[model samples]
Target: MIVAVTYRYTEDVALRDEVRPAHRDFLRGLADAGSLLLSGPFGPAAPAGALLLFRADDQAQVQAWVDADPFGTRGVVASATVTEWDPVLGTLLPAL
Candidate 1:
């Protein structure tokens, strides 16, 4: 199943400055493992929330993934919400 993992940074500027590299590396590892589908920040002018799409079997797996994030470990992410996602139409869909 696909899951949407959303999180907001506690200290936007500090978190970005301090953990950006580690965060990128962590996402890269997830991509390499075929778990991360898409991920990015809310943009420079926006709040420090991020959205991550993941293909995983269950919420436990999603939680585990989030728990291992450098951002999470460093307290950059204040909280996260993991929700089951059903892609009705988008680039995420397979060619019919």
Candidate 2:
């Protein structure tokens, strides 16, 4: 299953900057494990948030990952929404 997580950052820019390296490292570990498909922060023109796509066995597993994120652990994330995603046609992801 594919799980999509959206993270809205807090207003604390300094904290977010401080925690970003650790956050990226954590996500890199997930990607190395073949769970994180893709992830990126929203463009500067957009909102202050990020989108993460994960290939997981279930949403619960994705939730666990989200719970362990540095952003969440360090209080850099203001809010997060996790949802199951289905990709019918996408070159980046394998065909369903």
Candidate 3:
């Protein structure tokens, strides 16, 4: 299954920046392990939030990742939400 994780950062961009390196490394690690599919922050004068795509067997796996994230541990992320995804129209038809 694919899980979508939406992370909302607090107003302190510096906090987010400070933790971003570790966060990116963590995501890169997940990518290497074939879990993370894509991730990027919302930008251009928008609220601080990011959308991350992951391939996980269940929400618990995704939650585990979230728990390990530096952004979460360091409190850079103010809130987060995870939802299972079903991609029905993409080139990766098998994903559905």
Candidate 4:
């Protein structure tokens, strides 16, 4: 199934800044491993939060993946949510 992992960052400017590189590396690794379908941040002009899409068997697998994030380990994520998404429309893949 497809899962959407959404996370909100804690209000820690220093920690957030410190983890930015590691976070990017982690996402890049996931992309290389073919687990990360899409990822990006959310905010007005910059990024305040993030959304990651992954293909996994169940919620546990998704949780494990999210838990491995450097940002998650550093408490950069104030909260995280996982939801099942049906890709009824998208440009990255063939029409469903």
State the local distance difference test value for candidate 3: 0.90
lDDT of 4 at 93: 54
lDDT digits (tens) for residues 51-73 of candidate 3: 99999999999999999999999
For candidate 1, write residues 19-85 as lDDT tens digits.
8899899899998998898898888798778999998989789999899999999888888999998
Error of 2 at 20 (Å): 0.6
Candidate 3: misplaced stretches above 4 Å? 92-96
As for candidate 4, its clashing pairs are none
Off by over 4 Å in 2: none
Ranking by lDDT: 2, 3, 1, 4
lDDT of 1 at 16: 65
Which ten contiguous residues of candidate 2 have the minimum total lDDT?
A: 87-96
Model 4 scores a TM of 0.87
RMSD of each: 2.0, 1.3, 1.7, 2.2
Q: Pick the lDDT winner.
A: 2
Score each candidate by Cα lDDT.
0.87, 0.93, 0.90, 0.87
Worst 10 residues of 1 by lDDT: 87-96
Candidate 3, pairs of clashing residues = none
lDDT of 3 at 47: 81
Give the residue spans of candidate 1 off by over 4 A.
none
TM-score, every prediction: 0.89, 0.94, 0.91, 0.87
Model 4 — which ten-residue stretch has the worst lDDT?
87-96
**Clash pairs of candidate 2?**
none
Candidate 2 residue-wise lDDT, 14-87, digit = tens: 99999999999999999999999889999998879999999999999999999999999999999999999988
